[model samples]
Target: MLEDKKDGWKAAIALAPAMIFLVVFMFFPLVNTTIMSFMEGFQFRANAGIFAISHRYQGIGFQEYINVLRDPIFLTALKNTMVMVVISVPISVILGLLVSVCLNNIKRLQNIFQTIFFLPYVTNTIALGMVFKVMFSTNNGLINLIVETFGGDKIAWLTDATTKGYWSALFVITCYTVWSGLAFKILVFLSGLQSIDKQYYEAARIDGASRARVFWKITVPLLSPMIAYITITSFIGAFKAYESVIAVFGRGSYIFGPAGDTNMWITVVGYVYKLLPSLMTPGNLSKASAGSVILLLIILAFTGIQLYVSKKRVHY
Candidate 1:
């Protein structure tokens, strides 16, 4: 009993630093944001003596939430984010799985191929974005160069001149999101594939199972756990997408394709980021906090649904 108790104390001591860090950075901020979200007629004042800004609400109600939901920019962000989630997640997962399987089958240069596919993940997002920007540049970009070589007109992919509403810019953004995320997903699936016992594959092959049948029955079922995990994380990440848009369209106002509203491609987190610089406006902090809270709830709800559904489908 004494030894066990002493070991328990040591374990607690080992975990203390992480627990404290989480409380200070994650837990406290979440709690504070939740409180701020409810503030109505919120006021912010700076006290030089304390070197801190103080804030309070005159009447706490649903005003912050109401304001966020009523904003057209927020609505547009919500739409783009939803489209991103719906489109990007599955495509990334499927492509990653396919590439992983192909890489696993190759007997030669497999490590080199795996590294090539994973290079984007290890590279900086801003750098990759710049490379992609050059590739898609309107005047002399690689994409335009190819198009012109084939007698097609040059198209401005990121600017407001694109005639396809938000589709052109959105296409560029979605492709980046999918391509950038592929490396991690491919790595995960490859790890899962390697962990599976060879006996299963051998048995399937001896039984003369077709490639399609073997894949769906053995590989897919074995990988369902990884797939579920990736899907959940991808959905959450897609909802919080901000930097990719910034990377592709830049900080320029009215750059979201044909509609040309700066807010057109603004994501939920992007909206929150834009509002955070202004502390002088009444309830401004509350509005940003409310937006953050809504995004949290959206992520939680989607995660919950995925978890529930995965219980039925996920093999492990």
Candidate 2:
């Protein structure tokens, strides 16, 4: 019994660091944030600097959540973010899978091509976002310069409205998003492809199957798991799409153009930034917390749906 107890204690000691990290870094903050969501005000002024302070209350109710739902800007941000995900995520995944398949078949200089394609994955976003902003700039940008070379008028890639009363921020965001995202998708697909059995392809060829037939029949079924994994991750990453948009187009202003004062490109996360200072007001903080809670629920819903559909599709 003593020996068994000692072994258990040793195992607990070994796990202590990781447990501590989870408690402090993840669980603790999550619990605190959830509590804050229920609280009235964001900041409180106490009576004294040290031990002579009292905690006062200024509580809010469901009105905060009601305000978020009624806000037109919040709805616009949601629409814009959904538009980006619809365009960028699937294209990125499909292109990545295609490139990974092609690269896997290459017999020479494979490492060089892989490294070249993978370069963007490791690059600093702040610097890359700036470069992309310049490239996509409406005036004197490289892309605009190229258009002028072809006798075309300069186009405002970052600022143009796609449709009347619609923001075209997705175009500029999709450009950089597709560029930086390819590397991650490629690596993931390559790993999945590597796990596929070469014998399956050989057997299919022996049966007089075409390359396309073999890929459809064998490759895709086996790769569905990887595809699902990448899809979920890509969905999650869509929320982080603000950096490039903000870099190309300044924050707190209209999204599409100077004339397009629609506030179309403000994502839910960006709304948090937009409403931060107003958080001092007891009322607004509750609304902001409600927004945060909505975002969390939306993400969870997306993840849950993906998991449900993907599980149904998985063969083994």
Candidate 3:
């Protein structure tokens, strides 16, 4: 009993730093944000001491939440984010799995191939987004040059939002998201594939199973746990997508149409960012907090659903 108690105390001491860090950075901020979300009237005032400022809060309720839900820009942002998540997650997962399988099958230069595929995952996202932006630029872009070489017109891929609406921006963002996201998924899947027992493959081959049949019957079921993990994480990452848009479009940029500004390709994170500055005025703090809470709930709900489904379907 004494030894066990001593070990328990040591474990608690070892975990203290991490627990403290979480409380300070994560738990406290979440609690503060939730409290702020219910507040309505907020005012900043200078204290008697110079360089000292204080805030006053009033009216605790759900009005801020209502305002955020009703805001057209927030609604559009939600729709665009959902569209991005729906499109990018599956495509990225599929591409990652295929690439992993290919890499796993190849014995020669496998490390080089794995490193090359994973470079994008390690590279800075903003830099990758900027690189993509230049590649998809309206004039003299590599893609456009190829198109023109084939006697096709150059496309205003990013700027032509005036005619194409959200799609123009969506295409570029989705492509970048999938490309940048592929490396990690591939790495995970490749690891999972390697860990799978080769005896299963041998058995399938002895049974004269086709490559497709082996993959579906042996590979996929074995990989389902990794697949479930990747799917949940990718979905969450897609929902929080923000930097790619900032790197592609200027800050606070909106999608345009012939009629004028049509929509913003801003994700939920982007919407939260847009509202953050207004918090200084003590007016939109609640709104911003409410938006953050909404995003949190959304992520939680989606994660819950994924976990529930994975329970039913994941082989492991």
- Best-performing candidate as measured by TM-score: 1
- Give residue 170's lDDT in candidate 2 (0 to 100): 63
Descending-TM-score candidate ranking:
1, 3, 2
Compared to the true structure, candidate 2 yields what TM-score?
0.85
Which candidate do you rate higher for lDDT, 2 or 3?
3
Better candidate by TM-score, 2 or 3:
3
> Each model's TM-score?
0.92, 0.85, 0.91
Give the better candidate number (1 or 2) by TM-score: 1
Model 1 CA deviation exceeding 4 Å by range: 47-54, 161-165, 252-259, 278-283
lDDT of 3 by residue, 189-264 (tens): 9999999999989999999999999989889999999999999999999989887777665433332221245345
In Å, residue 225's CA in model 1 sits off its true spot by 0.6
RMSD for all candidates, in order, please: 2.7, 3.8, 3.4
Candidate 3: lDDT of 183? Answer: 91
Worst 10 residues of 3 by lDDT: 251-260
Score each candidate by Cα lDDT.
Answer: 0.84, 0.74, 0.82
Superposed Cα deviation of residue 228, candidate 3 (Å): 0.4
